[model samples]
Structure formats: C-alpha cells, structure tokens
Target: MAQHAAVDDLVKLLTKANYDLTLVQHRLDKEFQQIYPHNANPLKLVSRIKKIQEDLSSLKEECRELLAAKQDLIDKARTTLVGNRSLLKRMQASSGLPLISDSDDLAYTNLNQIINEWTVQVRPKTGDGKHDSDSEDINQLLFSAIVQNS
Candidate 1:
C-alpha cells in the first residue's frame, strides 16, 4: 500500500537524521573538550546523567572525610546534586530519541553547571593542603567523564 511505502520512507529519513546527529555530537564534543578538558563535555555528561545519579546516590554523606570539610562546600554540593534527579527524569521522558535537541537548553545548562561544580578544586579551604581519601571519589568521577581520546 502507499501508506506502507510512506512509513518506510519516514523511517529511512529518520535513520539518516540520527546518523547525522551523532556526527554532530562528536564534533561538538571535541570543541567543548578543548575549553573544558578537565571536566566532562556537557553533552557527554548529559548522556551519562543516569550513571552519575546512581554514583551520587551511593555516596556516604556521613563519611568522616566529608564531615570535616567546610560547611559551605557541602551545602552548595547538596543544592547542585538535588537538581540532577530532575534531569535524570527529563532524560527518561525522552525515551528512545536522542536527549540532545535544540529545545533542551535548560537541561544542557544544568548539566554543565553540575560538571563545573564537580571539577577538582571547588574552593580553597584554609588548612593543611592534604585532601581526604573519600573526597577523591568525586575527583575520579570528573576525570572519568573525559572522552577516552581526549
């Protein structure tokens, strides 16, 4: 039937678009990596939002290492961390289609913000320069965000 042929054409068109979209995503990732080499590119961060959320949820807030740190750092981290839950939900709503789209500026901004805050040094605490072992988890998380070739 003509309708079946039309549907086949639509699927083929969408497949081509999706392929083109991936190439664009990689190009964007390379550009962003230059500016944010230490942090995960925002697009990759958004793509991995679920994995990050799971890692965040499993953190032991009561770890002695975290408790001794300045309160402000903890406070700000808490505020930023809460927003990721909603981001994960938004990604879920998109289901099979790529989450990256022209209309996702807010989500992209939020994800970039999260990546910024998690970068190695949030602030300079006035104390011995040594850092706690538990806090290193966050450092590793950020480092892992970088693309392997980057």
Candidate 2:
C-alpha cells in the first residue's frame, strides 16, 4: 500500500512537470512566431532567439531529470512489491494456507502496462529543429539577414 502511494505521488509529479513543459514550449512557439515578422534589428532578434533556445534546452534537461526520477520510482515500487509478494507466498505455503497462484504476476503485468502508457504520454518533446521544419528556414533567414546587415 505504501509503495502504491509512493508511485501515485511520483505520477502526480510527472504529470505536473509535463504540464509545465507544455507551457514552456507554447511560450517558445509564440516567441518564434513573432520573430519572423519584424523587419527591425535582425541582430537583436537573433540574439533573443538564441537566448530562448538556450532556455528551452535547459527546460528540456529538467524534463529529462523528472522523467528519470519517475522511472526510478516505478522501478523501486515494482521491486518492492515483487519482493513482498514472494515473501508472502512463502509464508502462506509454509503455513498450509491455500496458494493464490499468479496473483502477483497479474498485478505486475498491470503495473507495467500502466507505466508504459504513462511513459509514452509523458515523454518530453525533442528539441531538435527537425520537429519544426520552419525553424530551419527561420535560421537560414536569420543568417542571411545578419550577413546582409553586416
């Protein structure tokens, strides 16, 4: 029960972190959109975009850390529950109690399924510009603009 509670708490944390990341990405998208329409100060705009990219990179690192922590918690909970179930089965068998066969196995399967679903849902978006091809064009525009200005 305690392990279940711990896992629940970690899931909540992971959800919150994912939400925070979404907000950050949305902000970055908005900022990126505004950068292209402006005809003023290409150097300044490039500098600003570079800073935003740096911040986005940092946020991604944080998301990765949170994901890793959530994975660790799930692993620990799985290990502890499996160990407890094994011990209980031994105790029950020694006491001539009727064995409940494969109950732990079912629980473990369900837990793994749930964790896999959450992992797929909560995985952070990669920061590589390939995800948004427009970003590549924008980078080229910025480069050309800077070169022309210089």
User: How much does candidate 1 score in TM-score?
Assistant: 0.33
lDDT of each: 0.59, 0.66
Residue 57 lDDT in candidate 2 = 72
Clash pairs for candidate 1? none
Candidate 1 lDDT: 0.59
Summarize candidate 2's per-residue lDDT along 1-150 as a digit string, tens digits: 999999999999999999999999788767766875664445567788999999977965675555556656766887898798889889999999987767556786787788666444333333343323233333334334434455
lDDT for residue 92 in candidate 2, whole number 0-100: 92
Off by over 4 Å in 1: 47-49, 58-150
Estimated TM-score per prediction?
A: 0.33, 0.44
After aligning candidate 1 to the native by TM-score, how far in Å is the CA of 15 from where it should be? 0.9
